[model samples]
Target chain A: MAVYTEVTDEALAEFLTHYNIGSMVAFRGIAEGVENSNYALKTTQGDFILTLYEKRVDPADLPWFLGLMEHLAAHGLSCPLPVRARDGKNLNPLAGKIAAITTFLPGVWPRRVLVEHCEPLGAALAKLHLTGAGFAPTRANALAPDAWAELLAKSAPRADSVQPGLGGELAQMLHGIVANWPRNLPTGHIHADLFPDNVFFLDGEISGLIDFYFACTDIYAYDIAICLNAWCFEKDFSFNVTKSRALLRGYMAHRALSEAETAALPVLAQGAAMRFLLTRLYDWLNTPPGAMVTPKDPLDYYRRLRFHNAAQGPAAYGL
Target chain B: MAVYTEVTDEALAEFLTHYNIGSMVAFRGIAEGVENSNYALKTTQGDFILTLYEKRVDPADLPWFLGLMEHLAAHGLSCPLPVRARDGKNLNPLAGKIAAITTFLPGVWPRRVLVEHCEPLGAALAKLHLTGAGFAPTRANALAPDAWAELLAKSAPRADSVQPGLGGELAQMLHGIVANWPRNLPTGHIHADLFPDNVFFLDGEISGLIDFYFACTDIYAYDIAICLNAWCFEKDFSFNVTKSRALLRGYMAHRALSEAETAALPVLAQGAAMRFLLTRLYDWLNTPPGAMVTPKDPLDYYRRLRFHNAAQGPAAYGL
Candidate 1:
């Protein structure tokens, strides 16, 4: 069970009246998280996951979550489709909080991920970006392109004390980045959390995706950059060229990158590095206690940023 | 100012009643971190950091945090010495939380960490372990060779699904590791978080050390493994042999390795890799949505583990 804010299930079932998910069958706390409360349910007819929207999930994002599922399902992607309520409303009030149920897709996250996994994940991302071609666009790109400055600013005060000139250099690099960010790449819905855990696997295949909460329309290439950061890096935190090549080739196979997308990748990679580094760095400076959360080392991404910063051109990363 | 908690200056002031510190002057929230709430504070005579225990910091472990700081400070280490409270107690009760303050060292964490940092940190670790010769001793040795099973078990469930019989193999590996874990070779104290951020630099020279939260007694060689994992791995997650060499050679200079220590490098590296893999994997499976924390890819350490798994002997790592 996660850190659900004192809400009880008996109180939560009140909202199920709005939804037509058959009789409340089996609901048990999912032990896979520390934030929201999730109950993997099994009704007379099917299996679904009931998610009790926790404090971190904004109420406004409910529709987006529902709508994205509908859109992705309508577009023929394998994902957890949100179940509509009896009132034909997607979201329902439960346990004095917002809650909803989504059909669960069966799959396992890969453990011994190899260069091979990179190819499919990249290609799947290409297809996923294309699948969200006409969904309701989102405005909540929390880790978007322009947030580097704000994040660096937050970390600036302690930068000299923590790591001299780190704040200044990060700010300067970001300024240079904004002035030259990529434009006009294939845009569609993106699964920002393309980490291995979110991508479900069934018998050596990517069965379906989870965690659409972070999905949105953005530069498709950035999705590739995220995967590269996510999948292509080696254990020592250096780039695995062979792995990177496999991933890029896989992405290109599914959706051919335009000359612009191709041209923008190195900088895109750098931008991607900056994005992860800034967020990780911000987290490093401002971690909340008792959250049971450990901030990822920003230095990991900092070194990657430095690597990409030194790249002379896109060809360096085989973009 | 962290998540759902706050640390009052009055409480910190109250806690500062004992100890040699002059007076608590200024304290403010650290804007970075996803685990603990840290405040940069200025005492009447010097700078210090006040950390209010947050999630992931169990209340029962407060003594270890305070005692390690006290112990390290007593041994002439330049780190934060926990301030005792007005009740003549070190741990203070504030905001329904346990908190402590330590002297802040002046220096930047190395930006371009070089070979030079390795030996100092290694020697420093050796010195700490030596000074920790004998105190009121009995604490969980996180780096102790015996803890590998618990480490592997945490990540075992998911790993079993991903790689069949993987958990058993890891368990067996642990059995062999414990049967052969290096022991009694100049064991004293160890700083588990020997990453670049915890190491300070002035003029690119090792100026001082801080962040002793993960300090414990264990195999002295395990300290080297921790550094190898921290320093040798690049952001892209690739292993850099040069950096690994620098780190290992640096450590070896302070505490020369016994033939057993030398022979233990490869297996210890594997155990180190597994330790990080388990923690990161635990994080991967258990991270909460809406948690500002971004889980580090367990795959990064998985790759490191895989690297070590393939090595035939300890000489492979040049210990």
Candidate 2:
């Protein structure tokens, strides 16, 4: 993560003065991310993640991000609670940006995930979805169906190709999708980035879920589609139909799908796939050189797009 | 993005002396990434990105990342050129991490990608593949196929309704693709992440390619699959066969595919699809609460995966 400005020990100590997490003792930088500078802090108060919101994270969103943690924690889901300052605010603008101390929860991310765990994740997600439903605080999906055509419209011209007539085909696909995406589905909060890195487990149990900056109002079942792609498939990149079923069964058990939701699954998956494919593609094409950032393979998601294109039905995903 | 420790502006000047760029007239945090802090630095010489490698960037591989930029630039790609320190070193240690400066190019991420850009992206990628061929630096695909499998193994237990029975099927699929991947077909440095965000353009032309952290020695065509998934498809998430053809055609124009590379197209695409689906899936299950990142939807790629899975020939992609 990016730590552009270094916080002195005294500065950190002073920053923690207002929070109730405890006393600052020691802090260590987490060298895994490419966005923000994070220090796994060990304070007399407790363990926490001391983050300086990097440029990538819009400063305006800090309170919303932090506020969600407090909200979710109070509602039931376990999360790292942002320690509010003496001013009775969770935010502490520091170093020309926002910074905060959040209580670090105790569960390690599961290295080995199982169907049983998927059950909990599905159930928890359902609960979270239900909780987020109609919550007073609302945000829109940053990358929504409406923006898809526009994003692709701009990027297609610059595509590198090995085929003579492929460019036209790409246009056709864009046109086709624009003509077919299902709208008017249930709109609510979605954990847009629910990857393995953000999950934490303890003794085979999904102890907590973190990261909510992308959480926004969108088709609720689209969240499930995102999960299907994330949890049910194998590393070889093929769908494990049975595992797919397990994850779905787990989800349905928690948040029973509406008839409408079921009908939209296939296309929603497509939308979701395209969303990722486009983002990966965009990131791939635009990543600045000489940066320490890593670029994901766009083809990786291209194959995924292929899957949803021809999926016979939601049943095909064992949904 | 998090400037926790405010530099008196004087300190920044001092620290910059150790940087490689000609001279840093002004610098400020621009964005915070999951991996690095990006600063739009206005050097007396030019605009550059001052990237401070967070702890996540392993120090050992810094050289490879640096060298790749030098190599790609030498190959005539318009990307960020790393600035060396006064000691004539490309690597610099700062804030308890690695950092560097890179020349900036001009381009706007297409708000909407069009079909026509696919061929150029494809063709340009072919050039990258050719130039980066045999240009071995330091890092291998740290998160290659094997590592992907290992990640799955760790998360398998958490699959919502995982059926190990499908493990065998997955294993076979893995074997099928692995046995046929174009390893030696055409060795080159592949811009693993060619997402729309990563590809830059000037006046709608592919002016520069960036983000080579995922660049590795692999079948150059695999990069094609990445782009097809990226540029050819629409955001609605459908696999536009025609668009796929265009992207492939674009790549073919720059570099003729070998029989092996052509033969491996579907398989490579299949593998590519699986890779994205898996990573997206992993992200779905592991989102860190409060982080602003969005997890990609795996269903988005499901259709693409099925296409590759059912591929009849390279002609399908118009390769």
> Which one wins on DockQ?
2
lDDT of 1: 0.68
What is the C-alpha DockQ of each candidate? Answer: 0.01, 0.02
Candidate 2 deviant stretches above 4 angstroms: A1-5, A111-113, A161-171, B1-319
Each candidate: fraction of true contacts kept? Answer: 0.00, 0.02
User: Residue by residue across B238-298, what tens digits does model 1's lDDT show?
Assistant: 6677777666676666667788776777778787877777777677777675464557777
Predicted candidate 2 versus true structure: per-residue lDDT over B178-289, tens digit per residue: 6766566765678888877677655447867766666676667788878777776666656677767767777888888788888887887888876776676667667554
Residues A214-233 of candidate 1: C-alpha lDDT, one tens digit per residue: 76668888888877777777
Please list the residue runs of candidate 1 whose C-alpha ends up more than 4 Å from where it truly belongs after superposition: A31-35, A136-140, A160-162, B1-319
lDDT scores in order: 0.68, 0.67
Using alpha carbons, what is the TM-score of model 1? 0.49
lDDT of 2 by residue, A104-171 (tens): 66554443455666777777778778776646777767788778667766656655542344345556
What TM-score fits each model?
0.49, 0.50
